[model samples]
Target: MRADVAFVNGAIWTGDPGRPWARSLCVTYGRVAALDDDRECAAAHETVDLGGRTVVPGFNDAHHHLALRGRRLATLDVGHAAAPTRDRLLGLVAHKARELAPDEWVRGGGFDQNRIGGFPTREELDAAGGGRPVLLSHVSEHIAVASTAALRAAGIADLRRPPDIPGGRIVLGADGAATGLLLENAKKWFDATLKPHRIDELVGFLDTASRTALAEGITSITDPGVGGLDGIGMGRADLHGYLTARERGSLGVRVTAMPYITTTHALAGLEPGVDGWGLDLGLRTGFGDEFLRLGAVKVLSDGSLIGRTSALHEPYCAHAPGEEPGRGMLAFDPERLAETLGLLHRSGWQLAVHAIGDRAVDLAVGHVEEAQRRHPRHDARHRIEHCGIASPEAVQRIARAGIVPVPQGRFLWELGDGFLDALGEQRSRSVYRMKSFLDAGVVLPGSSDTPVVDAHPMKGIHAMVNRRTAQGRLIGPQERLTVEQAVRAYTHGSAYAAGEEGIKGRIVPGLLADLAVLDADPFAVDPRDLADIAVVATVVGGRVVHGADALA
Candidate 1:
């Protein structure tokens, strides 16, 4: 049979071990038809010369929040790049508030109170908001700052004192007044009374996100919180967004979703109908087709390291006088987590729990172990997202349980400075234990955890090989991986994490034709310049999705 497309004259680093490298590839009907020297490719209808560029399997972000990222693109970006200082952040919010009518909400994110020195206050937000309800999320997403108007709107306006609850926090000032800081589940307060986005709005967000992912050469991504809708407007879920995007042909890349658990500890159904978002019928993980599918059930066991809320085994090092040293915080009653895991696992749903701190890691490990012991599923490839601050023993234990530790390689480059300042050198260097996970027989998958950081796979690769922070300081020299290992983690390892290794992640015959062409070879580039290597072209399903016009 004649090939549909012949990608010729390129240096391809096929992820498949048998055909590790190839000079050309052939694709027919969206599947890889040949590795090299396929005579049928000569009769192909289309022939594109790759100009001898370096090619690798397309990137797969094993864990990401594309919907949220898409929405953030339209929100006020107070990220380090946009508003680097406290004054600039408030100025942006105030400027945006001037454009809106009174009582309108000023919603935005990417403000790092750590970089701003401390949590922002309502007084500051009020100065720019003009009676508007302002809600600004931290860079970590685990924390947020709500203005007085927002607080009053949420029915917690009196600052002299605050309501206390389990698994959440409300930061208070010296006089016991609310400081506009909300942590963990308390961040939900600012989300009250907002209307959920229409299905069309969701489709727009998905399109924006998919375009960005394609430009970055990411062919696949798994959303960690699909149906949870914890922070969606209107307290309702946009569960139909994925299906709508797919139906409209706007979902440019493959997507896998893990339905997040609700406060009732019940899972959302596979389909959304008239009755609430929860289906209760019969749909576990591993549902759906190739473009849109179900992945593991996602659960966030603890907060984030940057937010200083990931339940840790020890006290945090960064602190001032009259302040709580603050280790971290964990969620879900143990019984609740175990019971939920038991039900999901027994129903054949794979699990993906977010565990950032060592303590949270222990809880995740124990729960998985207990659940597996109670009802064993031999090939269940449950995963722990972030696996952020694991110890040596924890890595070994995770490996023994056959759990893939999906880590964002970009964290070291982006958040390494804060990590070092808060945890000291020894502890900070040990976080994300990439090499150790591999050494301990674990499949250490790589991802971007985007919206929290840049989603560029090359940036993540740079972090993997250099272990350098944003300030150019090296944190953990010992954990540095070679280019091949780093690339595999982002490609094959990520596919394995999503249980799609059989279909994607490789350039072998019969696999899908998803590949990325880089301007320079990673192995030949300087370690620091790894991220500088541009994606010249990106191909998915044997068709070029990005930079195709540039190809000859």
Candidate 2:
């Protein structure tokens, strides 16, 4: 039988356990039809000579922020790469201020106080903003700093008398004035000014983000939050934004968008007396087809680890000068979290809780266990997002619950130094555990949490194998995973996290025709040089989505 496309003369890592390698494959009607010698010289409408390059299943990022990444791409970047010093960050703000109108807002993101020396004060932002409102987001996106003008734009009339916000913090300075720092839910105040007002605007952001994903050979991504109430998502129209993106042919990668759910507050369109909260008309997880499908309901249980806001059992190793010393704060009361988890689980929604600290992980684990016990669903596939500081006991419990731990290996290289500073030498070993999760029989999905760091999967893979920090110090030597295991985490493991392992991930016949051709073999390269390996071509459904000109 003839095929629509044939890929020949390559080292193909199929990612299937039964047939791990193939030299050639044929695709028919957007699905793999033949593999190995069976497809040699098969007649096809189109042929892609891999030119003896190494090909693997396209990368699948289980936890990413496509909307946020796209928005950041359009904004001024004060990140470590763009602005390594405090002066440089302020310079970028000044440059942005000059480019914007006097009344227009100046938006920027991806700044880390640790790397940039210290957080920008309202006074500094005021000077750089030049009468325009300025807003700069932290690398974690859990915290943000606003200029004095921006504070007024958010209705904060008096800096000394900021409004009380639940599940968030408005940090104050020594003089009892707002320090311009907003944490967790407190960032919601600026939603009106920062959030995209139109569905088309959000769709534009998706288009920009998808281009970046395709260039990196990312075929699928599970966005952790959308339509979230805490101002984290693009509001209620976020689902429509994805649909519009797909319809317009702008969304290049398959997406599994999770609705951010909170039981503490009433959702706008929820049916009265319903068992739980979700989209209207009983639309919950698994509602849409491939390319743009609903996955889990995301519930943030705590803040970020690097920001020192994630709820932890023990106090942090160190705190910024003049800052209060504590274990950090939880996003919700324990009882409220339990209630939310139970309601969602009973209503048949897959849960993905953002739990970073050990305390938060244990809290999520207990609640998920109770939820499943009260309403037994063997295939619920609940997840712990981040799980950054899981204890050994927590790891065992995560395995027992069969919960997927979606952690970013890229964090090892980009934020591991900060993690080391916060957790100290002792507890740092458990940070972003990879080998531990695999050894415990738990699936460890790979992710980048893009806009938080670089979204390149090869960088994540390198971090997983090397376990080194930006400063070249090893934080979790024992937690390092092998190169092969890291690849699986990015492919099959991430696919399993979204309940699509049977359809994609592996390049065996009958699966989706998605693959990435690399200029050099990742398995053959030195672990240190793995991040340098670049994708020469990316194929999705037998179509070359990127690097077609480079394809031989």
Candidate 2: stretches off by over 4 Å: 37-41, 263-276, 320-323
Candidate 2's residue-wise lDDT over 476-525, tens digit each? 89998899999999999999999999889989988899999899999999
What is the lDDT of every predicted structure here? 0.83, 0.88
C-alpha RMSD between model 1 and the true structure: 3.3
**Candidate 1 structure lDDT:** 0.83
How do all models score by TM-score? Answer: 0.95, 0.97
On TM-score, the candidate that comes out on top is: 2
Task: Please report how far candidate 2 places residue 525 from its true position, in Å.
Answer: 0.8
Please give the lDDT score at residue 265 for candidate 1.
Answer: 45
lDDT of 2: 0.88
Model 1 / residue 337 / CA error / Å: 1.1
TM-score of 1: 0.95
lDDT of 1 at 455: 93
**Model 1, runs deviating above 4 Å:** 231-237, 263-279
